[model samples]
Every structure is written in C-alpha cells, then in structure tokens.
Target: MIPSFPVDVERIDPLLASEVRRHYDRGGRTISFCSGSFLLATLGLLNQRTAITHWRYAEQFKQRFPHITYRDDSLYWYDGRIGCSAGSAAAIDLGIAVIRDDFGYEYANAVARRLVLPAHRDGGQSQFVQKPLAPVNAALAKVLDRAVKHSGSGSTVEQIAAKANMTRRTLDRHFIRHFNMTPHQWLCERKLEVARQLLETTHLSVEQIAGRAGFDNAVTLRHNFNKYLSVSPTKYRQTFKSSQQPF
Candidate 1:
C-alpha cells in the first residue's frame, strides 16, 4: 500500500499507524519509498533496524528517529521483512530485488530490461549522488574536483594540497570544515567505493581491483574493506552479486 504524499508524519492518524504496526508485527512485509519511511518509523517499526530514505532527507530523518540505523549511502536497504528505497528511481531497484526474491534473477532481469534500467547497480549512494560543486571558494572547489577525478590514482595529500596551492594544514582545515572528513579519509572512502563497484560489475580479480582502486595490493584492499565495511572483498562481492553469471 502507498502512503499519502506531503508526508506529514505528525498528522498520520494514530489508529492507522497502530494498525500498520500490528500488521508488520504479524509478519507482513513493508516497503517504503523515499519519505514514506517516516510512516514506518513513526509506527516504531524501524527502531534499531537498518533502513534508507532519500539522501537529501537523511539528516532530518535521523534527527526525528534517532533509534533507527539510517543507511544514507544505500540506494535501498532491506532488513528482514522491511525494505526502504532512496528517492524514486531507487524504488524501482527495490522492486526488482523483491521480484528476484519471489521469482528469480531471470525474471527480474527481464523486467529491468523492459524498463530500460540496469539489471543491477553496485556500490551505494556514491553511484547516484551527484557531488555538487558549491558554496566553497573557487580554489577549494577546484581541489575537490581534482580529488574526484584522481581519487583512484593513489595521489598523496601533499600533492593534492600543492594542486590547490595551499599548505597541508590549510587543506586539512578546509576538508574538515567542508566535508567533515580529513583528506585521507575522503580519498580512502572514494577508493573503496570504486573497488566495490568493480567487484560487483566487473570480472577483475581482487588484486586487479585493488590496483585500480589505489590499494597497494589485494591484502591492503581486503584489510581496508574489512575495516570500513566489516566484510572482506570476496564476501562483499558474493553478497551483492546480481546473478550467478561470471563477475
């Protein structure tokens, strides 16, 4: 069932919300798109559950429902019988996943082909979120652009700072203020994101993916994957693989 639009959670009828909660508690599956997660959350269905909403509203959702484990980076997320999608296009992705679960990969792929959408997408919000060049000074914007372009190149922080004609300290401050992360952290995240995409969509070996993702070797890639994602590269690939097809 679809929730009403303009998503004023406070206005949701208490009786209706209670009924929805009861339905889920009785083992009914629920799928929410974008701000519809608010309805499920208001019914207390999302407490301690991993879920996603439109990335633009992630912070607001978190503030309103602090108990939920909000996965801001996912296109969609599923925990047990509950599912959530980020924005409209991602709703289609979630639908395809449900189809695959009920039918099979072949049926889901057929539907995706008819819709002219990819059979599957890998990684997370990084693949869909457009990094806006905004609000920062021209120099900082240029530096950020360069960082995105060269994130998989194993570029040094000193080199990036030099490209911006800023001291390392100055670069660090700007990155912290603007990105809420250090340069090294941002670069590592970018590299790992790229590696995840490769793992899902390509037939590359772990060592090959590591080199392309700026890691020194497969060992380093595995170490960083475990540190950041709590899963080894091989395991991550296996978990997210779209079909039994090679790669």
Candidate 2:
C-alpha cells in the first residue's frame, strides 16, 4: 500500500488506519516495502525502531522523519514489530529471510532457490542504491550531479563549497534551505548513500568503505552511521527490501 510519507501525512485515510489496526491486532509482524516504509514510520510505530526503505529515497526519508533511524545498508531490516526492505528485488530476499527465521533454514533455502536468487548476501539495502540525486540548487546544484556520480571517491564539503564558488557559510545555508541539511551533513549523507552501493556491489571491507566514504575510520563511520542510520555497520549489510509488501 502507498503511504503519504515524503508527500503528505494527513492524507492517510481512515480505511488505511483501520487496516493498520487490524494488522497490529493480528499479532503478526508489520513490514513495509519501499515507499510503504513511510506508513509505519508516520504512524510513529517505527520511531526508534529498526527499519529500511528504498535506498534511492533514503536521504529524503531520513529528512522527513529524523526520529526514525533509516537503515539503507540492510537488505531487509526487522526488529520484529517493524521491518523495512531495501528496494524492489530485496523484497524477495526479505520474504525468504523471514521465512527462514520463522520456519527453518532448509525451508528458507528452498524458497530462495525457488525465487532463483542467492540464499543470502552480506548486508543491507546498500548494494541496491547507486546514489541518484536530483540537482535543485542553483550554483552548487551543477556540482551536485557530479558529486553523486563520483560519490565513491568521497567528496568533502570544503572541496564542494569551493566547486560551488560560494563561501563555506553560504554553501551551508544553501544546503539547509535546499536539501534540509547543512553542507557537511548533506555531504555525509551522500557518502553514506554511495557507501551502501559499494557494500552491496563490491567486496570491500569496512576499512575500504571508510576510505571510499571519506570517513576517517570504521569507528568514525560507525559513529556517523549510528547517529543517523541507527544501525551498526555490519548489521546494515544483511538487511533487505521488498516491493511486493502490502505495508
């Protein structure tokens, strides 16, 4: 089901509310697929809860609900009461993972093979998001596109500010006004965004990811990761996302 998150919160209707109530009462897990993560999140049930969403929209998702820790690196994230999947394909992985957890590894393996994907992967939705961005700023907006394309190289705020040809203070203001974050914050988010990609797409170690993400070390990476994403660096990788979910 579609949720009004990153769109409108008041738009969630009575019918959907009733449905959610029923789901809650059923005593089963409540899981959101992709944008549907917005629903559980908006209901505030996901606050301080482990969850995930489509990696491409992770930045906007985090911006809209800072209370909820957005785990982009996970293939499928679940704290039992709530769950978030990475993207479309990760949904299948989530299904299998849940089945394995609920049923057994043998059955889960059967399901995974039936779906024709590897039984498991290293971690979160990170592999699925390649860090696509919409350039909306004026001067630095031109550089935003370049920034995302080379996100793997790790761009710094000072360096980016210079590229935008604006004073650091001006760039910081623009970042907040345009993207709802300071320039440094936005750059960190961007680095993490692509970090997920490398985690999933490449056989990189945490140290390598740290370097590519412009983080000083795994500890620093974990610090920033825990501050915003709310999940440990290792746990984020094994997470999942599913588009077939009904929310």
Candidate 3:
C-alpha cells in the first residue's frame, strides 16, 4: 500500500521502483492513495489500467500518464489486484473497500463506524457531492432517517412518505430535488446495502437474507443484486464471506 505524496515530475528513484517491482512480481496487491498514483504510473504498474488521483491533479496526471485511463469522478477504484483512490478522505474509502475484500462486510463496517463514517461508500460513488439546489429540509432529513431505520421492515414508499406527513408526490419531488433520484431509487439503494451486509456477515440463506432485506423473495433479491451489482447474492456471499471473525 502506497500512501499519498507530492507529485514531483523529476523525482524518480530507481531503488524505489525496483522495490515496488519486486513486490508486484511476488503477486502482491498494489494500491495507491491520492498522489501515490504518480509513482505507480512512473513504475509502469498503471499502464493501460484505470486509475485516478485527486481531482486537482487529474489534469496533470492525465497529461503525465496518458496511457492510463483516468476516472476523475470515482471516489476510488479496484480491479482485483491493483487499486487507486482519488484524494485524502477518499483514501479511507479505498482502505475500507480493501478491508471489505480482505476481511468481510462486518469488519469493514466496524472500522468505518469507528472512524465515524457511513459503513462504506462504493468505489463507483461520485468523488464529491454535487452542490444541491437547496439545503436538505428537516422533513426530508427525517424521512431519510426513518426510511433507513425501517428499511428491513418491507416498508412501502407510501408508508415512508406518510411517516414524514408527506404525500407520495411531495416525497418524490423532495427526493428528486435533493438526491437527483426518485424516492424508490434511494430506497432500493439502501435495500441493496442491507442485503450486501447480510450476505457478507451472516450465514443466512438467500431466502432469509432476502426477507431480512425486505425483498419480496429470493428471486427478487437475486434480480436486484444482479441488476444493480452485476452479481448474484449467493455469488456475492461466496466471494466476500470471511473465515476469520471481525475485531
């Protein structure tokens, strides 16, 4: 794992490159946080691979490493063995992602909670929040909190809207204004997050997890998992379940 560093165009060190190369040759994972991508690119590890750095450095890094595919909008990215994070806080997001892959969802969530952050942001989430047209309203905030708390209860959008004393149209308007998505879309994302957590942390069967996550059934769970994540729940569990317990 390489930490952030200043981007220096004339700072190549043969010794450092040789050491990083040796690790790569040993089949170890390579990860760069923020400006460390410059070193990774300099060592040829990022050649033809998708990468990112701080948005401030995106232009310079793209010019310097034009062969690498730079995604300026991603918070972080990992393709199995090699990974890159966009900026400072984004490094933590990448680290949690690594923990999710190496350990499991429960452990990753614990680590994130300790750091006082949401469980984990997907690598593909936007690198920064887009400026909202207006500040989030108190009712909208309450609705969000309520929806999350009741996410596993199979609550309908109408039920959630009523809890905030909102009509479905009002709720949809507020959701679109604040999140740029419908209320149902936001709810589905939360459900997916809940389903993934159960898959990685529990030995529950797919049907059980589906019910816990408020999906209609195992088929619904599988459909949503595949539609949103391009993977099935069973396959996701198989890939992410950890043998060791979380700290």
Backbone Cα, N, C clashes tallied per candidate: 0, 24, 0
Question: What digit string (tens of lDDT, one per residue) describes model 2 on residues 34-151?
Answer: 7788777777677777667776777878888888776654666755455667767767766666664454334555677777876552222222222234556676777888887887
Give candidate 3 misplaced runs (Cα > 4 Å): 121-135, 158-182, 242-245
Candidate ordering by TM-score (highest first):
3, 1, 2
lDDT of 2 at 192: 80
Q: Where does candidate 1 have its weakest 10-residue lDDT segment?
A: 122-131
Full-model lDDT, candidate 2? 0.66
lDDT scores in order: 0.73, 0.66, 0.79
Candidate 1 vs candidate 3: the TM-score winner is 3
Better of 1 and 2 by lDDT: 1
lDDT of 1 by residue, 116-224 (tens): 9865532222122222323767886887787768767887788888988899999898887766668888788878867876887788999999999998899999988
lDDT, model 3: 0.79
Residue-level lDDT tens digits of model 3 in 127-155: 23222257777876876787788788887
Model 1 earns a TM-score of 0.60
- In model 3, the worst 10-residue window by lDDT is 123-132
> Lowest summed-lDDT stretch of 10 residues in model 2?
121-130
Candidate 1 ranges with C-alpha deviation above 4 Å:
5-29, 33-38, 49-134, 242-247
